[model samples]
Target: MKLTVLGCSGGIGGARSRTTSFLVDDDILLDCGTGVGDLELDALRAVDHVFVTHAHLDHIASIPLLIDSVGESRRFPLTVYGSPETLRILRSHIFNWLIWPDFTAIPNRHRPFLRLQPVKVGECVRLGERAITALPAHHTVPALGYCLDSGAGKLVYTGDTTYCKPLIAALNQTRNLRHLIVETAFPDEQHGLALASRHLSPSLLGAMLDELEVSPQVYISHLKPGVGERIMAQIACYAGRLRPRALVHGEILEF
Candidate 1:
């Protein structure tokens, strides 16, 4: 299995900044953010399943556009998986026909272009030899992290979470964990705002990392646009022992 970082920034600014989204191989999208807009129509058509992390606009901004652009070209409905609460938020806000057309009921209910599936924590959705498992995440809204296991190695993505001990405990028990893509959306100076928004700062991230048992290659993502360098530098000072690297856009990780 391979995962491509389409966007890792908390917000967008220059060419390098595109919100949070990751493409898993050719068919699965971990989160359909603004980065999905960068893909060609052919690439967009290849996406079959989208596993959403939360209802935040930054993480799901591209979902409606993706379905609108390729709904007719695809042979099957584009399936989107999220926690029940997250799916409810999507139905109430996004696919309610006011914000965007209700693709889940478009054309006909029986033959709709989109499908939404609710996945609970600890449930693993398997496709062929690969498995995508929902993990716990603590965020302002109903949220979830995901574990992508391909039998060979496992990659865990903590999408938009704060300091969650339950997540850390789950990670400790995860075997063959090769990569952990976590988020630090603010610098150490913004600890108050970080806590208020349920995001992680450098110091908070350090505290979370101190409890990890598995030593997977940790990658820090979702840095707020302007202060990304400062956040990374602070991460170096606070969590340097783990040596978490900043996740670069367009980078690919294979397992």
Candidate 2:
């Protein structure tokens, strides 16, 4: 199994700064952020499932567009998985006729272009040989991290969160955890804003890392565009023994 980093920036700016999204192999997407817009039409149409982390605009921006772009050509409905609350938010806000045409109801209700699947924490959704398990995440809205088990090893993605005890405990229990992609959205100076927004600063991330029992190859993600370098420097200083590198777009990890 291969996982590709489509985008990892906290916010959009230039070509390099696209919000959180990841392409799992060719058919599955971890999030539907702006980075997905870069894909060709054929590539977009190939996406069969999207496992959402939250209802945040940055994380789900391209979902509606993705459905719209390829709905006519595809034979099967595009399935989007998220927490029940997150699915509710998408239905109430995004897929509503006012915001965007409800693809679930378009053409005909029985044969729709989109489908929503609600997944709970600790429950694993198996697709062929791969398994994606939703994990706990603390954020402004209903959110979740994910554990991708490729049968060979596990890759954990802490999708937009603050310091979460449950998430830490879950990670400790994961056997053969090879990679950890976590978010550090702010620099040390914006620690207060990070806390208020339920995002992690370098200090908070360091604290969380201290509690982690597994020694995975940590890759820092979702860094704000402007202060990313500074935040990474701070992370380097505070991360103790575990050296974490910054995640870049277009990077691929194979298991």
> What does each candidate score in C-alpha RMSD?
0.8, 0.8
Per-residue lDDT for 1-255 in model 1, tens only?
A: 999999998998999899999999899999988999999999999999999999999999999999999998878899999999999999999999899999998878998999999999999999899999999999999899999999999999999999998899999999999999999998888899999999999999999998988989999999999899999988888734578999999999998
Could you tell me every candidate's TM-score relative to the true structure? 0.99, 0.98
Per-residue C-alpha lDDT of model 2 across residues 1-255, encoded as one tens digit per residue: 799988999998997888889999999999989999989999999999999999999999999999999999999899999999999999999889999999999778898999999999999999999999999999999999999999999999999999999999999999999999999999989999999999999999999999988999999999988899999999879737678889989999876
Local accuracy by lDDT, each model: 0.94, 0.94
Minimal lDDT window, size 10, model 2: 235-244
Native-referenced Cα lDDT, model 2 = 0.94
C-alpha lDDT of residue 54 in model 1: 98
Error of 1 at 244 (Å): 0.3
Q: Which stretches of candidate 2 lie over 4 Å from their true place?
A: none
